[model samples]
Target: MQPPLPGPAMILHRRVVLSAALAAPPLAAPTLAQAPAPTEAPRTLPARLLPVPRSVSAELQHRIAAPYPANWDHIPPDTAGWRALQAASAAEVDPLLPGLIEALRITVTPTTIAGVPAFDIAPRDMRPDRQGRLLVHLHGGGYVLYPGRAGAGEAMLMAGFAGFRCLSVDYRMPPDHPFPAALDDAIAAWRAVTAQHDPRRLGLFGSSAGGGLLLATLLRARAEGLPPPAAIAPGTPWCDLAGEGDSVNANAYVDNVLVSRTGWLGAAAALYAAGRDLRDPLLSPVNGDLSGFPPAILTSGTRDLLLSDTVRAHRRLRRAGVVADLQVLEGQSHAQFLDPTVPEAREAFNEIGDFLARYLGT
Candidate 1:
């Protein structure tokens, strides 16, 4: 088995061991167990996340601080997990996934969408009663996640709850296929849908970094004079590639897991940008003109580190005269929406459908 990427605790422990060995007294009696040390752990929460409004429940907060949830298999999008996530999205996670999903009784289909000559997944035919809305999802991993599966269980629920076609775009990822590649694929997929279906029948969607790109895509579409989709619902979007948003530093420790929000993600932004300014309005939709963008329904969890990014973007949309619906889930994180098995995840998907049903059907 591949060694798992060290989460916070493991990385911190390794750092401690390294620091202690450097500070060791030359004459001190010590065995291998007597590790060295670094500066004392801070006695209080960092000052950044404090200013942002937080609605996380005490219980949920406790759970997030614990090791990865038993229900959520959140492996890092390092090398192997990326490959696995890719394979799972192409087929299903684990060869046994079909059997497990069958046990849950969800329906899935391996089908191609109209525009892009690439692979994507759909799941709606099997569960008749679950049908409602369709959603086009863009998975987020700083454009580098391998096997970027959006998870079958969650995809099925989002389609059922969201009330329309949910086309999850498997855009070309990065360190390989950069900026315009992914954006072009998204636009093509959207055009394919609009060609046969009404632009008003569509609802664009994504989470985390995916959420940010959803906004970016719309901006680009408007600039290119492409037809605008009916509505958009981006959850906890990572829109600010330049790390100019205050939360990038403020939510640092409190957000956990996502260490140095500005570093690797920033680098990824540059790589995907293909030498574009990190803050270019086209790249950072947060800075783009959203005045005529479609009505939007955005979701964010209180404990999510990107809480500010979502809210800030919503506020901008309101200023732009674009109708915006912002929902802050009491206790959740960035990818909480992908954990459909959880009540919170289920509720998030249901709300997404509710928003689309209201806007698109109008």
Candidate 2:
């Protein structure tokens, strides 16, 4: 026969429950021989093999498939070696500038801003809305490379794409000058530019090491009571010289450009630091207070070695109650967003342009 269904009163009754429990077989105590063994948690993750993602543009995919740089493992032995390396790198990049400049319909003129050498880039056909807006650019080369005109390519690209007049600071680098020299030059340029242009209509941008310097410049400006820009775009910024970011190791070999910090990147950091503390706010702006920084739009890639640096900087800005936007592209490494030919590159510049337009005044 079927048992009676439990009513609310029967279910709530402790005596009825006890009677039912008494009719059931009691559970036997666990024996030592049958006890489950304790399991220790795994301490490490297994290595993963990742393939080039098909989601990105074909051009970007091709870049992702390219082999790592041959000189990725070479560390400069001395100042001369570093200079030679810089020259070699500049040689490879400089030749491409003429075509890019011509195609982009921009002109680059060498000039001095407060005694610091700089490049003035202007689009031939400037947009009406951007006529009074100005942008300061700092070129990236790990603080030892891309001196003089070689560093102006990024400025030219921005001038052409973003349609804003750009001042690219040809900041002094290490071996001959180190530490404060680059920062000093950048500050000098900013002072000169801000004196001429309305700070409310000005913006700052850079990638990698230059991005780090851009943030540092803002910090230094705040300390000196200088006016801040309206907005900033720091893409894939190498803001943590201490190598404390997770992507530094996670994306080591995965990043085609900056393969790992253990390579020349670490050496470059040491050279730039020049015995100073890596965590110094100027040296590594991620550690600095970002309470009053201007609105920032940061960009990074899924495969960028400094992805964590950019992410950390974005989080810090947001935590400080600053308006911050972060864009992480799929399957990119290092400053691949700066590649002029790729659609993603154009998209990146367009996003920065939009952000600047939103913040900068007429």
Candidate 3:
């Protein structure tokens, strides 16, 4: 004889019992002695297996097949090791810039703003309406990678695609400078840029660690009485360094880049944070008040580990009465939109360009 399957009545009864239990919840706190052991406190979910969807473009599908780079799994043992890894990553990415620059017809020049290193990017054929507008970009590299010319890739892409002048801030990072250093440089650059351009014509943008930094910069700028940008675009922002998002676990092994927080991602956070509290508004802007923030366009993908972070930030901004737009790519993971070869990448930037143009002045 076989066991009986759950009948509709039984299911209804279960739901009724569960609802009654939920409605009756008003238990007092348990004593420490009565509390369950810490290790046994957390409930576990069954393991899952996911497949890459065919909904995205073929190029993106190929990218999804091999999401991470060769060195994505290697954990650096020391500062020297981290530097070597950074150099290797830069070497791989830097060579492709010249071709992209020529194709996009954008000129990238190294410059300093408020004594901080940066790159000024301008398109040859600028949009007449965007002539007076300026965008300040911050590059994403876990707050430690992509230094010098290597960090200007995203700025070039935006300038070429969006027809706007961009200043990519090559902020100082950890292993030498940590915590407040990058934030300080960003603030200084913001102050200098605002001095030259009208704040109403200025926009801010960045991704991953850069996205997180962009939000932190806004919070710090607000506290310091600095004028806000007309708009902002934070793509796949690592908003919570403490890794408190559901996707952090749900998207584990799902996102090709920044594979898991337990790996290099968490290490980078610890390295950049130094000994500072992870909840500091300057470190994790998600915990900060975003009441007076300007209109924002937050981007993420279904498979991105930071999807939760981006969604949470957008919700927070919306709850604070700000006009917040969210764009979720079909199958991207992490900052895959940075890849110019991907069709969706272009579409993502186009959407961002349109969003910024809506708020920016001529």
Could you give the C-alpha RMSD of every candidate to the true structure, in order shown?
14.5, 10.7, 4.3
| Ranked candidates (lDDT, high to low) | 2, 3, 1
Q: How should the candidates be ordered by TM-score, best one leading?
A: 3, 2, 1
lDDT per residue (tens digit) for residues 2-118 in model 2: 226655564557654565455553525323443235554423667887788889899998999999999897999999998898888789888888898999999999999999999
Q: Give lDDT tens digits, candidate 3, residues 256-311.
A: 88788888889899989999999887899999899999999999998899999999
Stretches of model 1 off by over 4 angstroms after superposition: 1-62, 68-100, 103-105, 114-133, 146-154, 160-163
Roughly what TM-score does model 2 have, to 2 decimal places? 0.88
- Each prediction's total of clashing residue pairs, residues at least 3 apart in sequence or on different chains, is 17, 0, 0
Cα misplacement distance, residue 286 of candidate 3 (Å): 0.4
Candidate 2 off by > 4 Å: 1-48
**Which portions of model 3 miss their true places by more than 4 Å?**
1-49
Please list all clashing residue pairs in model 2, or write none if there are none.
none
Candidate 1 lDDT tens digits, 1-362 = 12257566767777756666666656275444554353454346634433333344444555465553232324435555545544544454446556644544445555556544432334435344324434577767666553334333344456545434456776776656678787887887777777766677667887776788888888878877788878888878888777777666655545543545544555566767878788877577889888998889888766566777888899999999999999887656655656544566667777777777677743
